[model samples]
Target: MVSRQNIIRVADFIDSTTRSWRTELILNTFSKDDAQKILQIPLTHIPHDGFLV
Candidate 1:
């Protein structure tokens, strides 16, 4: 489970980002599972070239 601090931080970050920047912010900050709740863009899922699955 993500700590309250983490959740709060994510919420704070998301709130700071406008709609136009939300996708980029989420892509930069969250893991796939973490991204689940904050998904705002379909194209931001750049799960990497040699990134381990």
Candidate 2:
């Protein structure tokens, strides 16, 4: 799980980069099995303007 502090750090980093940057943070919970499946998939399979934590 991404902690609140870590999320804040990421947001701060993004803000420091450029004020014009558009940012969105999402939090989701998944079962252990589902999470394992997700981890097994290559990141290239996921699409987004930003990145996954």
TM-score of each: 0.31, 0.30
Q: CA lDDT of each candidate?
A: 0.47, 0.39
lDDT (tens digit, per residue) of candidate 1 on 1-53 = 33435654433443333323355556566787776665744333333233333
Tens digits of per-residue lDDT for model 2, 26-49: 214345666555445433333336
For model 1, state the Cα shift of residue 23 in Å: 1.0
